[model samples]
Target: MKKVLFAMALALAQTAWADGGMDILKSQCSSCHNLTGPAPQTLKELWARKGPDLFYAGNKYRKEWLVQWLQNPTRIRPAGEFYEDHIKPGEKHDEIDPATLKPHVSLSKDDAQAVADALMTLKPKSDLIAKEKIEEGTISKSMGEMVFDKFLGCMACHRIEPDYGGLSGPELYTAGDRLQPEYIASYIRSPQAWDPKIWMPNKHVSDMNIQKLVHYLEALSQENKNGK
Candidate 1:
């Protein structure tokens, strides 16, 4: 009887949360994020987008990470989501004015939890991520770094280490800590599947190299945590 009552209570609580979360998303997030997609299909359409599409948030993010990030929002993209909008013509890469950057909207703990619940409901195609699995610590750090920087030329757009790499994409120094392993692998493998107009091109690397890249990111994130 006790177990039955507990289960019933949990169901009711979850339903209440789901409803509240949807309400919050509609009121607060719909303006910036596209909850429904067929992501942008052209460079012009992509540049017009104001934020990254969140239609795949359930597949892309960990629930705990989303909850915490919602409460204490930070910049993920080094350049704005559309680089053309943020980077000026003559300024050097490091010369971006921090003061000019717009901060993400933060939420209270309760609201953040509600919002995360809603975001977590936005799953993309399951098959797109099902095959990706990162066996932690399997790849040597040097090999993974080599694949990321030289073999793939990812460094041309993304920042892997502090004060290093380009600024057009998101900083990857904390990617292992911030992103799901499946998301990292899946996104790298076929970015177009997630966002047709996203700037990240398909590299057609071997699956082994993809696994190495994920491991590398995890190792880098762990090192950063320990160093701090």
Candidate 2:
């Protein structure tokens, strides 16, 4: 009983220290990132030099993923940027040096949680563009599939099913269900709007086309049976 109690106390102390670790992140990371809102123009337009938006950090990433990424950010982005190739002749990439990041990344275990807590609270006003359902039909379904696989080339890196594409991007077999139509449209139109440097390709999808594509994506998850 004493041993268990002591372990619990140690765990609590670590969490407290981790929670306070936000200062380190703020000092080192904020220069390249925004906690919320539409991305900055300099970063948004750079195409090559950009960073991930942590506005919806809480919702988008698992805690473990964030910790591991902070410790060592590697090929999380297989492609330099969705539109990196357009800016330069060859792909360019950057990452925090493991040696430098190790010391800088450290936090009083308690501070880590606090930092995560603070970051998790960065919610965007446009959280859900809309909540209503649209008419479902064959055209939307077929076109959505084609758009995902060919038009936008989302299949190039994202795995949709029996093997839609490569393993570079996250699995989107359930994007139709997981993502909101509005969010999808916004992201497709400009991934930088959400994250300065996302791995998805930048085909420069237009707003109207983006909407249509998003409709298709919203229908993919197992949760949305009707996909309306």
What is the C-alpha lDDT profile of model 2 across 121-214, one tens digit per residue? 5556344434323344333567777877777677767765533454445556555544445555556666655655455667987655666665
Cand. 1 TM to true fold: 0.91
lDDT of 1 by residue, 102-219 (tens): 9998999998898888888888766787978777557677887788888889999887777677778888888887888998998898888888867778999788888888888888
Per-model TM-score versus the true fold: 0.91, 0.45
The best candidate in terms of lDDT: 1
Give the CA lDDT, 0 to 100, for residue 137 in model 2. 39
Q: List the residue pairs that clash in candidate 1.
A: none
